[model samples]
Target: MNLVDQGAFRWHTLWLERANRSNYRKDGQILNKQAFVSLLTPPGRGAVATVVVGGQDCVACVAERFDAACGRRLDELVIDRIFFGRWRSREGPGEELVVCRRSDWVEIHGHGGRAAPASIIQDLVEDGCREMAWPDLLWQTSADPFAAEACIALTQARTQRTAAILMDQVRGALREQWEKVIRALESGDIPTASASMEELTQQSCIGLHLIQPYRVVLCGPPNVGKSTLINALLGYQRSIVYDQPGTTRDVLTTHTALEGWPIELSDTAGLRDQASGVEAEGVERSRQQREKADLVLLIYDASQSSPEVILTEGSGQQHLTIYNKMDQRSSGLDGEGIFTNALTGDGVGDLVKAIVETLVPLPPRAGQAVPFTHRQVKALKASQVQLFSDQPQTAAAILRAAARVGPVVSS
Candidate 1:
């Protein structure tokens, strides 16, 4: 697939429907709002448009607008059977209007026009149909929004690893983890509980490792083959490699899979003590990127002897030192890291393996308790912090708060 053609071939239609309910409460508790979803996204210009509505009054509201093509009224229709119909506006006097209604819901199968669906939705809104955002609709009625989000994420996720991990999470990995922890707590097994918490934390971190790409920044002195190392790992010419010291004037990025983990690898300008002008700014930016990176690959050319390369203080423990040009005469340095000839693609796989090891240390169990959102993680951390603090009651309160974010039964 061409990156340039991404989303270009499709004639996109944007939905601007707002969540609406009778008596109008956005909190969703005042009235169980009917929810709608579209199966087909624009690009295929299919003749028919299908909108699915879900909620308490979905079937009844839809039945009112529908006249089944088979001479069946939606009010007397079966739950799963499709009724062919021309929906007319109830507010209007006659059958000049058309919309499709189903059991407890309505599907307006109209001509695929730029404005037809919008016009239909507007008609529904005018007739007191509540238009709601997909998220709000799901959250109000679904058992777990995180699980639903996970399902959606799996559908859109790019890689097989991502799809697999998200699918498992949605299937009850997090719930299982919570259940194990709660069970241990109920059994008065404090040691088991502590161990379970630690395991849960590790599982959560691993889940994050699965879904999000880890940022790995390359840093080293000028002319140490930092760009060369990046190209070697990526197996493509992603950056300009030059004999000159400051060839890479800005940070260049390329993404690749390291083992099963996704990685965002950055090749930044060489860090040096002094630079004339823009190169100096580039060097400062390189330092900042290094500090922010999840992993830093510090490169040093084996040919260079004067200024020994070492990681700066802010570089994380995930940092790996690359000794490039290892084919040259030995500089007598030895370590438990990669020694590579970036020019020839030798030992780059070993470097990638090291990165994968750092990113994902183990195969996470299918049903592990992993926080699916940053909010869940934050709440869990807050609970853990409270647990460690002197106030036991406060810690319980924090746990309750975290429990509120998910389901209390899981907590």
Candidate 2:
């Protein structure tokens, strides 16, 4: 069975934080570490940026461009001391920076949210320091590719939910999970190995979504207050609400968190048989959004005399029936759907909780092992399939390769 159809591995993140420690050592590349420069921290603007200069001549290389304000030479500066200084460059006047000497490397902390760090890195590279991407440089520190990948994936984590899970893998939970599979295979216990692999494979729905949030699309017939429902869920006026039918003539998407898990909510154009021109195109897009959504909210105008006529909606899609504008409705809902007054925000809380539960009914806890990438999921499933088939031993071999290699392993 294809358990996860549209990119949900069905896992949670408490382990993503386990892999942030810097080990800085890899095999056969010790000699290459002699003179190198890299942005040790994640790219983009932040409070501060850290540029790492390491190797045999790292001290001299940084000293040539940096001048200490205390009149102390770079070589004579105390190790680990936060010395304030100016990093000189030929193009223009330099900016104030804080340089700290480590046992083997010097960390240059400078103004972030600007191009200063990149400029300094470029100058260092011209100074004969080899430049490397943060992940490739990190890969050299540990032979454990899983931990290395966890460190890399941590940078892209959108929510704490995802980062925490990646951290778990970095702290050895990810590798340990696979080690169990390998041990079972080595013992000739096919059942144990296959079951374990399948569980991780099943977790792909949650695991893969840690970085990529699940897309929840709001859709229904025209003038059903779809805009109001989306605004109520988002706690703001994101979608334009109006009395006119097709106000939102396009798919409007916004990122939000439902019970801590990141989810993308889409306010799409209403579906109507009479829509034409741009409105018709929008209606078509709304249908397309429903087809791709992780969850579809089939909204209904509770005030309408014939709300139940559209009951047989959203064919072949997982959806939740919601009765909106409840206060305006004349008759009782008969407990058929979740009732809400989108304009006043009544019953929205229950709807939010329901959406989260529908997507991830059982969230993964701390220390739980999960496959956080598509390649990892594919590898687990392929291994499990082979374990029960002709390639019995290939399961263990694949798991080993996945841990050794980053992200996806060749199955």
Candidate 3:
């Protein structure tokens, strides 16, 4: 579904504005005249839990079923007041958990567990609560459009680094970036417009990485210290380290962040002249990772052999060759490549810098005029249906079609 229609377009904007007025709050938009319910708590276990129920007349709907423990009527409860109460399962006569409600929109903060909160949710769902993901629910009731999108983006973040980046977006980082572009457009400054658009587009791309983690693999011969390098890069022991050849018979994948870019770092079994069955399978997986990686770090032992002895050609898109264990010998790389000792952390900063520079390009403008979503892509293509038409407005109509489905602020 389109991001706007999914309710992100409004929820985010209102949520942010409300947040500005008060630190603790949530906003939601109703979908199909039905109220949206979201479990603010994470999917798994936690100490405390938050459940947000919002929609038109959310206050009324929630007030009817929620009984305040302080002997206060739900209608008499002040806005933004935290009232302690036992959350009763709407499906039956049982306390769900100790709950609290907010003024503008109600927030139920209660004791957390797998059973209690889940039962509450199940009860609500059975009682006509449209059980939805937190992001989708917020999108439905959101008053601001961009904030809604930001919420979805933030919730989908795959890594802490990515989450940090998208958290910036949610706080109007992208909006400010787009405002600069809008200013340039208004001034009829073609050069500035083009430049700003280019810059913003780069930001948009980088911003997406925060939403979707990219795969990065370290590929090379076995015993080349690939695992050692991985341990060094990760700043902790992650992979098995043994001098025995072929010890790593399978690809070891780990999630790590570099310069706010989340990467799925993989250490594959070494590629060598002879291989056991397991090593062969690891080698095959290495090849697959190399093919899929956004960037590949090819490690070669400088003291042993050149990269040519291991991998013949460089990747077409993006890759780097590293000469590791430089402390053993200062002979330097026999061929052109980056040199580093994953053992002593020598040149590790450079390795990280190279990775960041290669992967995290700047983001695009907010509401990119061009199609970024599948729906917009399809709509733009359909506009071409009139390319061969006789109507004089065909080209203009097509352009309009592209624009309509393109970025536009919600009312």
- Considering every candidate listed, which one attains the maximal lDDT? 2
Residue-level lDDT tens digits of model 1 in 1-411: 222122211211111121222222334443344444433333234455445454557666566666677677676766545555565664553332344443334445565545656555665566566776444443444444455556544534556766677767666676566555555555555566567666767766766655577889998888988898888888889899999999988888888876667789999988877776999888888888888788888888776554465658745457887888878735655544577899888888888888888767776765555665665566556655644554334434544445432443212
Q: Which candidate tops TM-score?
A: 2
Q: Give the alpha carbon lDDT tens digit for every residue of 1-411 in model 2.
A: 122210111111111111113334433446245688877544455677778787668899999999999988789999878999999897765999999886667889898754988999999988899887766666655667666667667766777777788779877887898899889987898778778777777676788888788999988888889999998988888999889998999999999887778899999998778899999999888888788888889898888766634433555667788989899875644547788999888999989988988898778779888888766777787777777775767877877777664555555
Q: Give all TM-scores, in the order shown.
A: 0.78, 0.85, 0.73
| Candidate 1 wrongly placed segments (more than 4 Å) | 1-50, 63-67, 84-119, 329-336, 389-411
Flag regions of model 3 displaced more than 4 Å.
1-32, 70-72, 88-93, 96-104, 143-145, 155-164, 176-192, 273-276, 305-308, 312-314, 330-333, 361-411
Tens digits of per-residue lDDT, candidate 3, 1-411, equal 232222342444357337434422233222536655666665555566666765545566666667777777676877766776665554545664444445445666666657766776676676676777766555444443344556666655555555555556556665554455445444555456456545544454464456556687888877778899999989998999998768777888999778656778988888886786878887877787787778888888777643446564555758887888777644544676777888789988898888887786443334432222233234333432332243213423443433331242111
Model 1 score (lDDT): 0.62
Judge candidate 1 at residue 27 and give its lDDT.
43
> Model 1, 219: alpha-carbon shift in Å?
1.0
Candidate 3 has a TM-score of 0.73
Give me candidate 2's TM-score against the actual structure.
0.85
- Each model's lDDT: 0.62, 0.76, 0.61
State the weakest 10-residue window (summed lDDT) of model 3: 402-411
Clashes of each: 12, 24, 31
Native-to-model Cα distance after best TM-score fit, residue 166 in candidate 3, in Å: 2.1
